[model samples]
Target: MTDDRFLYDPDTAVDPLGDAEATRAAGRSSKHNYAKVGSGRPSSLLYNYGPGAIMDLPHFTVMSTGLDDWERMWRKRVDSPPEIHAPRLREVVAKLLRSRNVRLRPHPNQPRKTGLSREGNDLGVPARVFPQWMRCTGCDLLAPLSHFGYTNTHPYRPDQARFEHERCPGRSGSRSGKNASRAAVPARYLLACVDGHLDEFPYDQWVHHWSPCPKVEFPVLRMVDRTAGKGASAVIHCATCGARRPMNEAQGDAGRSKLPRCRGRHPHLDAFELNGCGDATRLMLVGASNLWFPMTQSIIVMPRSANEETSDLAARIRVAFASKPHRLEKYEATGDLEGLRDALDGKLDGPVDEEAIPDDQLAKALGEALTSGESDEDLAKWRADWDPVDLLVPEWNYLLTDPLGLGHEDEASGLTLSHRDRAPGLRKEIVRVLAVERLRKVNALVGFTRIDDVDRVADLSQRMVPLARAARPAWTVATEDRGEGIFLQLDEPAVAAWEAQVEQDQLWLAHRAAHRRNFESRTSDTAGPVDAEDRLRPPRYWLVHTLAHVLIREMALECGYSAASLSERLYAWPGSDGRPPAAGLLICTTAPDSDGTLGGLVQLSEPERLHRVVSSALYRAGRCSSDPVCGMRTPQDTEDFLHGAACHCCAMASETSCERANRFLDRRFLIDLPGSGIGFFGLPG
Candidate 1:
């Protein structure tokens, strides 16, 4: 279903064709695909990032598709991703949504499609987006994409050709001889400050800064990459004024000296300078790895409070009255408890406890709750109170206690966990839970950081970066998903024994020293006291973490899900008297908007399969494709500091699948290494 609110240039027609075929046929591609959705994205392109993210897009097409040109293109709202049905996730997600004052929509009936599709959109779901800047590759002119001409071209059908900005340098160059021959690409460089305001690079001001030549009206600029010297020696020159400057001087500390102050531009939302961010803009290339680092925290859903009953009732009521918000409104206004309950009972296919949540209370709660994201006031409040990393205490409590409460039950409410029979060393060192049912995991995109770790920032306000260009947006797009997993909790005695080792403490200290050095290098601030408790994980953490990676790799080979689809949540902490020590890892598979249970993950957890999977993973960790060199690497300030005997070939998993940002992993701790006796699973004498 197409979002009616999506902005479309009436003059342009967007086709559903995939990007590759259109590019191959030289057929007009969809302009919406650039920053919207589609399989047409180039391999080098990376989107689906939150605010503070920088990406490069080919300038020319803007969006390639059916209608080539437009008299004018207008801006519209970004459509939301399809919501996944997750009644179980509603309680926590609803609380979060409520805290932000976002409206809760009824769960979607069908599973939200995953990945971009060939049909010219993100699996047919397009985000409503309009980027503010575009750069002309031919002339190196940086301007908004809206300033350029529009065209829809199918190589063989020239009769449908059209143009908007006739005088644009990019268009002139592309059409100089005959038909338009070029498309503008997104400017590869953008600037952002610590305050989270992003803007185009001050290219014009930089080149013209040191030159004595008077600024000429309508100056022509060109980017020249010099091959003779260092890569940074590339230059930007103004033909009209004969002004020139090396690109390198405009970047880093050197660029800070030469460039103009930050203009407080937020091109995405087209908003700028309220009080004005006075910080000098730093030079950044689009697609820099640091441009966007998602600050995300996840929880393993476990049956927690009696509140679940109320939450389950709420979800049922929501789905029953989703299509009839007016009825819900009536119930809310009148507080007509009995009538509403009766109406709900008539429509709902399953039972809902009216007693758990009385009609009046439900109405009052729903009334107070913001379920629709259409109101401006609701949005403003949302941005003001946005919480990126919510406290996971409740979720953690649920995960730790609830699964065991189920006893040997194979499943409960579409969720289950079954203990496996003890293997030789399994029961002695690890508590057993072979398979888990409906392991629901919800991940939401809160904010992003550039060249800094938002996770380290203790202040909540500092982590809330602007995703919108203009004033703080009332709401931002986020995703909710569900999945199943395999659970393994280490035996407390085993973990204590492992931590007791003097050599283990030394090894952990070395990794910790490296971590401190790395942290200091990233920020000037001293490590927090909590760093010891949280960041400086015990030796058991490395062992469990590495084992998780090995198993993820082994499971990926045959588990229906790809390695990327599976994720790990490690629970490890040092023990102290009277306090419960936690040590376990939940390796599971999740999807954007599905029930997240295909049974493959749980199947691996079966007693017979668990033995084989764990054994194979440990065996593989004993060796490496880049052996000796990889296995012998030491943790130091300069290199391989965060790792030990762990590399992509052995212990590393995709960034998306790892909770620790792929750190605190060491294969040496999981298996016996040559000249190293630290393996948790005993090594030969």
Candidate 2:
């Protein structure tokens, strides 16, 4: 166990937001880059980052502390804080909550604080910092920072007084200057059970087993690297017990049996699950990218707030009522707003002032925002025009077919749209360019997983943590992003014909079976069984997904955007239960810091430019830099069994940009080869 004092350095203050000195010196507030990887994560990993997901930073790993505890980290509080204290990302939040059956409520209104450092730089918020124990690289002794000398270069010597190494007398047998020459860094090895319990590597017990120490109570332990492989080849030694063991088998399946049973620990909350759990603890490296996987869900914004025809009117109503608190009461009373006011009020620092605006004037504004002198028949016709049976299809239909839907009548959205002409040979497959002027994507960190494959887990509650200390939470912290995009709805006839092909269906099944077997093997037992519904998806879905990725890669090159800055949301589910087939891909720009409407993405939607982008993307996909070997490999031959005809140099997007965790992808179905006759594009004219 580490010294509890290192958990929080009370004397050592930090200001996470920015510092006064640094702000003044730089003539501006110090910049803070939270999560440099941008917010949108692959949908498969969304379950990993709910209320208390464990997030790894550069110097330390942090469990996203509960929302109620956020103020504890700041040194000072600002007055009249916004709903989240951070930006509210209006369009993003509105879109996500549109269909979820949950109301769109503003985040907590608390001021987040920071402090300045001596050298005029911003420091992290002055929150508690739990020391997950440190490893003395020189002696390989595992202990708290207090165990080593206070100097920059110091070895582990338990007898040394904290911050005072001059009076230590244990250096007699040590070589001159060699003793205390190297500093100990934090131990990277960690252990986690399926029960969401985390604990430090059990070094002491591993060396001695369950037997009592036959020697001194304070046995000296040293980690020695006697082999060429630094981490894998290193061996641990007990100077007191004379027992030694290697750390090479601490991660894989064979190592799990050798490792001790889990003790059930939650080092972040400073709490433990004391009821006892028998689940085998999995070994994890702190810096590994797979250690934390965030589960996220998003929705597209429709003109109608709730139902069909009313979407356009609802959007207009929201635009009118924004920034005008006085009109809220009237809007609420008239049923135009009703439940909306309460959700909007949370965004304010305090309760809405009753006297801000008169009820009659507010009514007049609301009325004017709608159709002037409109009769009940007109309203009835508008509502009748919407297909209430299918919730998402109507919204998608409006985006694809409604010309006035992307109209420039409203300037608040910062949206712009254009109708692009189809290129030769591509016209029969891709229908039209539904250019999006502006788009908002709000991703909520729902839960997280560790040392397990995402597909194996079915229940979210098993992986996620509550926002509060209680067993359940009513709220969680989320970030919303605003951006621009272009939607390309695949031709229904072309998609139907491609889906009907016998070879395409067989090809997809072969990959699916391989994927299922590989998935079962890699998934941890604790993750439980995979959901039956999530396992199988239509073949058209893969074709559209591959194209989405290819388009994003091409767009990034032509439109001056980094591939990492772009994200894709597929709407390609086959029609069922009297609904129309929804096959389209929306490739959009995402940035946590900006409004997201940079005009570069929408500009590429022009007919002439789009032709080049599609042609170039298809040409590149027909042949990869890692061809033959990459193209010839079957799903059974691949490690994950989830990819076919897709490699790092071709189909794979950055982790942040992909939605399916880079699974269920095959570029072979898109273009043709000598033996592969089922290419959807039909071999380039």
**Cα lDDT listed for each candidate:** 0.55, 0.56
lDDT of 1 at 366: 59
Compute the lDDT of residue 354 as modeled in candidate 1: 55
> RMSDs, each prediction?
8.5, 10.0
Tens digit per residue, CA lDDT, model 2, 290-333: 56555444554444322222332333344435546466556556
The regions of model 2 sitting more than 4 angstroms off are: 1-68, 74-81, 84-131, 148-182, 226-232, 241-243, 248-255, 300-398, 401-416, 421-426, 502-505, 527-533, 625-640
Off by over 4 Å in 1: 1-48, 51-100, 103-147, 153-180, 210-215, 225-234, 308-413, 423-427, 468-476, 502-504, 524-534, 558-561, 575-579, 593-598, 625-629, 636-640
TM-score of 1: 0.71
> Native-vs-model 1 lDDT?
0.55
Tell how far residue 134 is off in model 2, in angstroms: 1.4
The estimated TM-scores of all candidates read 0.71, 0.71
